[model samples]
Target: MSETTQRILPPTEALICFNLYAASHGFIRLYAPYLERIGLTYPQFLVLLTLRGPEGEGQPQGVGELGALLGMESNTLSPLLKRMQGAGLLTRTRSEEDERRVVIALTEAGRARAEAAAEVPGCIAKDTGLSEEDYHTTLEVLRKLRGQIAGLDGKPATE
Candidate 1:
């Protein structure tokens, strides 16, 4: 076979796709130790964190609203919410206006969990090489990219 016939390496797109997986793995690795101390798995922590507002000040959000924001299915998320409820970390209640819908709220213990999460930045500082500013900028860019991909025009892609 000619030299040109040799197998090519993965294409750039493939590399980018694999990079996302590897980066998520790296993030889990970096975040696990810190979050575990607060009794949260990565998914659970993400659920908790997403419920918060600026500086972790916010009321419990509705589960449908949370699911919509996370782009997750109720089938997948409902069980996790149940687990959180069992663990005394959060609550799922019926919405007053619409009894058919469920609302999710952090309990006192959930609030404690959020408070405990304040240690994450410091742990990340020790674990990851990215400077804080670089980290925040990367977060912004990634969120923007995600929003673009999700077609953020006042409605979710599902609609």
Candidate 2:
């Protein structure tokens, strides 16, 4: 279909939320092949990439902490964590000071996998067909949009 023709979306199809939702799925599809080679799903890769702290530092994060950072629910995240643990990607244990808190630390294998997947961003960027400037601008716009939406709760976005 021509670009101009595709622009004539139905009212329901014209929603920004729907576009964002579709884009998210497109992103997952784009990343899936690369992630598969590394034995990670898109969400699994996200968890590992987040946990792969500065310079491959395996910082221990509590389950709640990870949940908050990822904007995920503990109930949904727990099973994923268990799978990663079983796969030897990370270790999950109760905090010594607070047994109620479950802390997660990336295993060396997981760190290695994260490092290996570092080229993923470059690959995605290259495939996006957007100029570097346009890509960055889009990211900035999206970040601002997210902040503004989040701040609709009457809290300052900077907070």
Count of clashes in candidate 1? 0
Q: Give the alpha carbon lDDT tens digit for every residue of 1-159 in model 1.
A: 444534455454346557777888988898887887887888787787777655788577888888897788889899999999999988999989999899898888887887777668677876787887988898898888777877766576687
Best by TM-score: 2
Worst ten in a row by lDDT for model 1: 5-14
Span of 10 residues, lowest total lDDT, candidate 2: 150-159
Candidate number achieving the greatest lDDT relative to the actual structure: 2
TM-score for each predicted model, relative to the true structure: 0.80, 0.85
The count of residue-pair clashes in candidate 2 stands at: 0
What candidate 2 gets wrong by more than 4 Å, as runs, is 1-8, 153-159
Which ranges of candidate 1 are over 4 A from the true structure? 1-14, 152-159
